[model samples]
Target: MDAIALLELCNYQIVFPQAQTCCGQPPYNSGEASPAKDVAWHTIQVFSDKKLPVIVPSASCAAMIKHHYPTLFDTGSTEHKQAIELSSRTYELIEFLEPILPYNKQSDSSHTHISLHRSCSALREMEVAEPWLSILRKLDGVEVSLPTLEQECCGFGGTFAIKSPEISAAMTADKCEHLLSPNPQSILSGDCGCLLNISGHIKHSGDKRPCTHIARFIAQRFGIQHD
Candidate 1:
């Protein structure tokens, strides 16, 4: 919902394929290529209409489709060709908006300080750190602070965190500490998994800072209310 609102704010037409499902990253990352390919092929068919660009709210999902999908099939194969075509059209939400949304000259007095939590996949795979920072910098009166260890994982590597609770907890602790050190009012991220891990730890630790999705943050900034 927030993504749709954000795109509307940018004056772009949005399309949602009702049949679209997972991007197959979970199975792909877990060494289950067979099922992963099945999911990927389904996704490919859902978005086969090449006229519209594929905009994904989650950077991790976008990365899986754009980077990992091609590896699921042999080169020159039909599925491989479809994967490459899909990858070419896939883009993270922020990446899609960067070229469209201009800087708002009006300053937002409500939020003076905020921190950004770049997902590991976004930073490493999508190479979207600078693009996201550039977008945030354009917002008037909003100071964007990146944690010293911004590139570190937030301990939510999908099922990895579930399987290794102790390690995940330790890493989440480190990430939360860095995020709160700046005393920002809120933390914003592109990935839901990172936000869940970081926000869950903050709540458990009794911290007051709120963690929000980047799309929701953008919508709030634009005065577009969404549930």
Candidate 2:
């Protein structure tokens, strides 16, 4: 909902390709190349338009399409060619919005302090670090802070969390401790996986700080309420 509101604010004619499925990142990250390629082919076929920019909300998914899709096929193959073409047109939501944040309206006068969590994929793979943080700073009353281990992995490396639940849980606990030290009103991240990992830990430990996606945070600043 916030994604829709934010894109609408940007004056983009948003279209959902109902046929679109996964970008095949999960299997690819899990080291299953054959099944990953099959899923990639289906995704490529679904998003067949050569001219449209694929704006992905998740940094991991965007990175998969932009960086790994072409590697799944042989060089100079038709699939590889199409993957390269799609890669060139793909952009993460924050990446797509950085140059065109049009919401200039003032939010409530009350100040908002938020702790930001940038996933390893966003920081390392997608190369998306300050876009969303900078966007929040541009708003009327948002104050953003980074954890001491901001660059550390939240352990939700897609399948990594599933395969190594104990290690993943420890990382999440460590991440949550730092994220809550400042006692911010909310925690924001562009990647849902990180948000989920951190928020779930916080909840189990009886903490209640709101964890939200950056798009939703930005949308609220522009008076766009969730439905």
Q: Pick by TM-score: which candidate is best?
A: 2
RMSD of 1: 1.6
Poorest 10 consecutive residues by lDDT, candidate 2: 101-110
The TM-scores, one per candidate, come to: 0.95, 0.96
Stretches off by above 4 angstroms in model 1 are 105-111, 225-227
Candidate 2 lDDT, 106-209, residue by residue in tens: 45546989999988888999998878777777777778889997888987888889999999888888888888888899999999888888888888888777
Global lDDT of each candidate: 0.86, 0.85
- Lowest-lDDT window of 10 residues in candidate 1? 102-111
Residue-wise C-alpha lDDT for candidate 1, range 129-159, written one tens digit per residue = 7778887787766799999988789999998
